[model samples]
Target: MSTEAKRPPVPSPSPSPAAAQKRKEKGTPGDNGADAARATELAPTTPGVRRELLHSMLLQRRFEERCAEAYALGKIGGFCHLYIGQEAISTGVMSMIRPDDYVITAYRDHGQALARGVNPRSVMAELFGRQDGCSGGKGGSMHIFDAKTNFLGGHGIVGGHVPIAAGVGFAIKYRRGNQVCVCFFGEAAVNIGAFHEALNLASLWDLPVIFIIENNRYGMGTAISRSTANEDVLVRAKGYRMDGESVDGQDVFAVRECMARAVERARKGKRPTLIEMRTYRFMGHSMSDAVSGTYRTKDELEENMKRDPILLLHNRIFEAGELTEGEMHKLDDEAKAIAQDAWDFADASPEPPLEKLYADVYADTSS
Candidate 1:
């Protein structure tokens, strides 16, 4: 992990005896062992699938870039968090899951929503507080919900939704269903009591849930090293007796491979796995903190930007001869066009009607 020159190195907690033994038997998380190779079979490596993944990441980048512009123009309101550099994690993981699977994420969720097949236009409309939004404009930015796509919704509270994810997994197990539930939250959420509780139950009950920590290194404005004792978060899984792994979030293929293994474990064995994705967020915690305020230095940001997820994948696919440079440029252009259309749609969409305030808030228990 790259830290500012002034910061001290963060210490890692020693894993328990059992956990150490398991690590010895299975090797480290990022090792390209038999499990890693098996993960490849879980996801298609066809050129077409590769192109789709790249396009998804590009579309998310363009969409978030446009969202930033809209927020500056006062077209969007509320706490808007852009998933700029963490696109690869969402695009890669969502690619390996089935439509019947469940996905729940934190406030930085536009990327996951789009990756889960939620319409970009509806997502933009939600940001614009328009009637056509997935959440009917009421859940602007932070609470994008779409039941049709099995995207439970983006929770506003930090670590509050962790237990909810466990509940979803419980429901699946109760039904004797093979579906898996993937919960995404920031690294800071690991500190929350509910996060630990959820993981414990998910393991004890043998729930099919994959807990993914988007360790962007910063909990809002504070860096993970400053906030927590151990920056190596994967070790937390030892307490719950669940499998844990770490992945390079910037590499889409690596993200996909790690998720494939987790998904397989969840679907096949009704197991839970905790994944710590070491990624960086190019933007601030929200629109309020532009390019990250005083917590981090400009030079540090620049250094991290060199590993821009989209650019990394672009170079890889180009070198593999799966896509031409010209074709990649065209795909980027297409992504931009899609984002443009979403913006236009949001601009033309009407605000929520006064009657809609009471629409979904109350349940019709009389029925």
Candidate 2:
């Protein structure tokens, strides 16, 4: 990762109350007119970007919500991890990258995959384990891959994808391309050996890899305070002689700002940077985990909810007097319609043919 001097400080913006109210009601600011407009107004800070971030995040949240329901109804099988609250982290960071840039992450990857522009219908079909899935039904919720979009497969092993991310960065450097590789993992991954080894190699080669640790406070059931001696994940980068910093992952602007610097550094051929996003997950670790009060206290979850990223952005837009309530409703309706279309498509899609399982396996001689 690049050094601190190359990584600029992100500007902090105040949240608006109107945006908060909208977020509380709709789970996103883009669903509210004021919030969407405010996001548009701020587009100048990040050119050519409009309400897509909000729309994409909302799509992810809705898609995952449908998956949860499907899992319950037995329409989808296997371990399903919903990226409900962590939408901003992926959306904010991904907004800064180009289509050619690479993205790799762990099993909690639906949000990242969607943000990277994978077809929602294919993703949904994959969750349904259908032939139309991004992975042709071979990989489920934890393994979505779209080569055209440069989204690598979602790995299942804890911290297993770190080295793969570094390898992608090395490839980019060797090819002499300006592309950067983004490696997204959980805070628990820092304890794994892959994290250390990947960082060491990335730093030594000055590879353009950005290691983003989505520290949602818990590694499965264990909290950061319990699993590791140092809860500040960014501090670990010092050991590898790399630049690292912590950011408010819940805030879209904060994450976007941080990613902009990291992307710039990577494009400039600087070393990798380790960014620890201090965020939380509104849902359980997996579909098996309870969203209500179980592993964590209600108060603890409630406190985190107060800092909702969707609401913060919406309120800022409302306070700026940019959009109307009716407009926000239209956006929400559009997102719902899009999600519904994808679900319907997945429902109607056929499963993979039995022979296909053997066909794509390996090259063979004529019989």
In order of appearance, the predictions have TM-scores of 0.89, 0.87
Say which candidate scores most in TM-score.
1
Off by over 4 Å in 1: 1-44
Worst 10 residues of 2 by lDDT: 4-13
Per-residue lDDT, model 1, residue 250, is 81
Per-residue accuracy of model 2 over 56-127 as CA lDDT, tens digit each: 766776677677777777878989888878888998888889988999999999999988889999999999
Ten-residue segment with the worst summed lDDT in candidate 1? 6-15
TM-score quality measure for candidate 2: 0.87
Model 2 CA deviation exceeding 4 Å by range: 1-50, 363-367
